[model samples]
Target: MKAVIYGTALQWKLDLRSRALLITCYLVPLLFFALMGGIFTSVMPEMKETLIPSMTVMGVSMGAFIGMPTSLVEIYGSDIKKLYRAGGIPLGLSLFAILLSSFLHLMILSVILLVAAPVFFGASLPESLPLFFAALSIFTVVSLSLGAVLGLAARNQSRLTMVSQLFFLPSIMLSGIMFPQNLLPEPLILLGNLFPAAWGYRLMQGFGIRPLLGLGAILAIAVLACVLLWRRQAE
Candidate 1:
């Protein structure tokens, strides 16, 4: 399992170094979260600590749900399927490749936060550092599951990605990372509650350490991931 996680993670890092898949995964999501989100965060100090909710959780989830999965669909689509079979590797490898790539990108942006913590904002990590790490683990599972499911379902790469992005962007907006769920109109708040992002903020905010709907949500997501992955393994 460690090998699976690291192997997948390293390949993704290399791809960023060697490929054109920049910004969308690396720069854009962070920008959307940190910079774009800062436009709102700049006004709300209370919400400022919740930047990861907007940026990586939202941004990273997009990559996980769309980018990783689309790559799977593309790799498994007709011609590449034949080529991969001839090369003697399996479809699972393709899935792992894409997933690892998404996972690595999650870290790249988080690292920026680490570096920027002192330099840009003179901020130190909140006491909820444990929750922050827990949040990263949640990201890994969320992205992994979405990547795998979409990869399994997509007809082709672009088609899969387009569909994924459609879900991805809206998910970010609804995640309540940029805004709070309690403050939204009732309907929007209901919708936001359905996303991991809302839970993520609840977990990351000061409430992260306290028990509440946020803690319950995090546990639920973790259990859900285990169930889904178990199902996938059984298949």
Candidate 2:
């Protein structure tokens, strides 16, 4: 298990070093947080409060569902399945890699937001260690499993990038992270509920406040994604 753990971590670091994924690990989160913070800090105060969590969801979704696959394609390209099978790398190890990468990526972005949010905009987050962690874990697991699916499904780097952006855009905008779902049309609200990020946003909103239906929703998402992933992998 430890070998699997570190092996996955090493792959994540290697992915971060990849030219294709470098910008994502280093620059994308910063730009995202900055963009949302700058645009809504004064006008949409609550939205500013939710920026960190929103950016976090974006990172996890991208890392797991799109970025991991993108990196996998770059590393393995035309022979990914054969490469892994020949080496006896377990599917669990791949999940560990995707999960660790997604979790660590969110942690780094959180730290950056903690610092930048205060200095630039005088925003301070509520403190509640357990709930914060719980919410993050929920987001990480669902997103990471989804990333594994994307890795298995995509054919190339360009397709992976496209898929990841598709994941990022809707998840970010509809999750009520940068904007509230209430402001959107009723049809959009229903669509947002279908996304794991929406549950994550609710979890973050209630982190220091009160527990709601968020955790159960996230767990359901994780299970759903994993079941579908296993079925696909078995083929």
Best candidate per lDDT, number? 2
Candidate 1 shows a clash count of 1
Worst 10 residues of 2 by lDDT: 207-216
Q: Rate the local accuracy (lDDT) of all candidates.
A: 0.59, 0.65
Instruction: Give lDDT tens digits, candidate 1, residues 86-133.
Output: 786555665666665666666666667655644554344656667676
Q: After superposition, how far is residue 199 of candidate 1 from its true place, in Å?
A: 2.3
Instruction: Candidate 1: give the clashing pairs.
Output: 33-55
Candidate 2 lDDT over residue span 100-156, tens digit each: 765676566666766687688667574675677677776666666556556656667
Q: Which stretches of candidate 2 lie over 4 Å from their true place?
A: 72-77, 207-235
Deviation in Å, model 2, residue 93 alpha carbon: 2.3
